[model samples]
Target: MDIAIVGGGAAGFMAAITARRTNPSCKVTIFERAQKVLAKVEVTGGGRCNLTNSFAAISDLKQAYPRGYKLMKRLMMTFNHEDAYRWFEEHGVPLVTQDDDCVFPKAQDSHAVIDCLVQQAADLGVMVCCKSRLMDIRSMQDGRLELIFDNGTQRIFHRAIITTGGSPKGNNLQYLARLGHKIVPPIPSLFTFSIRDKAFCNLMGTVVDPVVMTIPGTKFRSKGALLVTHWGMSGPATLKLSSHAARMLAEQDYKSPIAISWTGERSRQEVEENILAMQIANPRKQLATLHPFGLPSRLWVYILSKLGLEAAKPWAEIGRKTFNRMIETLVNDQYTIMGKSAFREEFVTCGGVSLESINSKTLESKVCPNLFFAGEVLDIDAITGGFNLQAAWTTGFIAGSCVAE
Candidate 1:
């Protein structure tokens, strides 16, 4: 069988290698638009290339994917994180899991991971064509898939797999959709919110731990570390909420009000009681100098100012109304998200090809026989920490294995 894999990204490369491994006599070709393959993998995780996550069960892993959790649950059961780790280990690329369960190459370099894929494909006689852009694709009268390249090159294959990622520059989706497949509109995921707050200026390095961030009008909430930026807030918590609320935020034109709780572990009543105890412990101390409840001193001052409380006033002199206001700000700090900043290292989309169109068992298109889908191209995206890449590996392996047979 002659197999044509579009997009020389993580998914495409994995699919090519798997196809060749499953059927050594079959010819597998990977066409990449860019001069370099795995561009995102080279820069992902700050050059570490978080390959997979440590989540064991399909149920636990599906929680990270908001768009295609149900589909991913079924796909992961076939080839999940453990299988991915073992595949890498067999190929001489051992992986290590970090404290947060993010798995990376033991060499601590993305090039190591990319090199493994490149070498594996080469060893399996997979043709990796770089800078070969797929301009169009059509199903011939004989039921073969023909691909037209930008450089006036054409090739026909028995089967084709599209794993071109979620970039607007690529023609993978357009060409595949022209062949008659539903294309779900893609949106930016795993991004940070842009806020118009001056308090965040010159405080770009300030990070608050264990903060709860939520998007109003949506049932999205995340608790993790948050960073204050010149434009607004960022970090794990903000990015996770942004991903889960990507569609909602886009519908609002990225101008949505977000609520943040600095004390993620404490309730409003608990915060108020803690403040009362601090006030009793240091009645004569000024609010600015007291810095109660373990929050950042600058943030405490800002919260007091927002609550209309004088920072120089002693703790004993503050009225119950002001105390309540401060409690409210600490427990429910609100910020208007004016825009979004792409986490350029690993920006993923939450939606793509509808799951209903693909068979979960083999990742083969239910609408088209011998045509498969995988990776971010298939309406499946997960939060950070290598979950998205794991999905790609899983679906790509399944598609390649089933197609090769």
Candidate 2:
């Protein structure tokens, strides 16, 4: 048996490795368009490589996988995060799971993961062809795949797997579209929002835990740690909101209204009661000196200044109207999303080959038999953390394993 895996990303490498491991007699090759392979893996998790997540806090798979929860749930039964964690450690790379459930190499380096894959592929005798771009794939009458390359070369394989990850534009997936697979029209996911408010931007470097961010007029909301940056917001909360509302934000041309609950999911009445209690207990304390809800002093002062209230004024001096404004701003602060900023080089998208067009069990294309896909190339994406990489591993393993069979 011969297998051809396109693209040399995390998924591609995983697929190649698994294919060869599953059938030692089968031939496997990875064709990477770029001069180097695993470039994104080297920089993922700020170069530490967040390979997988423990998924301890995710009661619902949808919480982590916004787009392909059902597909991922089915695939996870075969090769889940726990399997990935064990696979790495058994393969000679020790991994550490952070308190946030993000699993990283114990060496705190991406090369550990990269080197492991490279060495494993070498030991398995899987051929890797860098600078070999796959321009097209044609199905032969004998059920083999003809892979045309940019270098004016072609090869025939019994099976072909596309792990090209996510394309930034729709046209990039035209090759797959021509094969009768429905393209979902790729759109950016896991991005940060850009706010033009100078006052809000001044709160850069301030991080609030358990913030609830929501998009108005939509059922899109996410709660996690939010970090205020000089440009805008770039943290788990903002990224999760971006992932959930990726298409919506793109529809508005990245300009949308956002509401943030600095107090997490506290209700309006609850916030009001807390403020009232604070006023009664600390009447003599200056508003600036005694912030409610244990909010950062800088944030409290900024809120007070934005509300046009004197920070040095006693808490008892706050009028009813000012108190209401305080409650609103604290629990339901509003901001304008001027644009979006990609989350570093780890650019993720929520659309690709639609799952409806593929066989969920083997990841084989119903439209194109013997052709498979894995990783972000499908309509699978997740919020920040290690879910994205985990999807790559699970789907890649399934594709590789089934292709070998």
Model 2: per-residue Cα lDDT over 139-171, one tens digit each:
999999999999999899999999998888889
* Model 2, residue pairs in steric clash: none
Query: What is the clash count for each candidate, in the order shown?
Result: 1, 0
Q: How displaced is residue 72 in candidate 2, in Å?
A: 0.6
- How close is every model to the real structure, measured as TM-score? 0.95, 0.98
Best by lDDT: 2
Q: Model 1: per-residue lDDT, tens digit, 1-405? A: 999998898999889999998999999999999998999899989999999988843346445888888877787777888899999999999889888888999999999999999999999999988899888877777878888999998898999998888854334467666666777778898898888878654567778888998877778898888988888888888887887888888888999888988888788888999989999999999889977557788777778777777889999998888778788888888889899988888888766677878887888877667788888888888888898898889888988888799
Q: Highest TM-score among the candidates is held by which one?
A: 2
Worst 10 residues of 2 by lDDT: 341-350
- Candidate 1 backbone clash number: 1
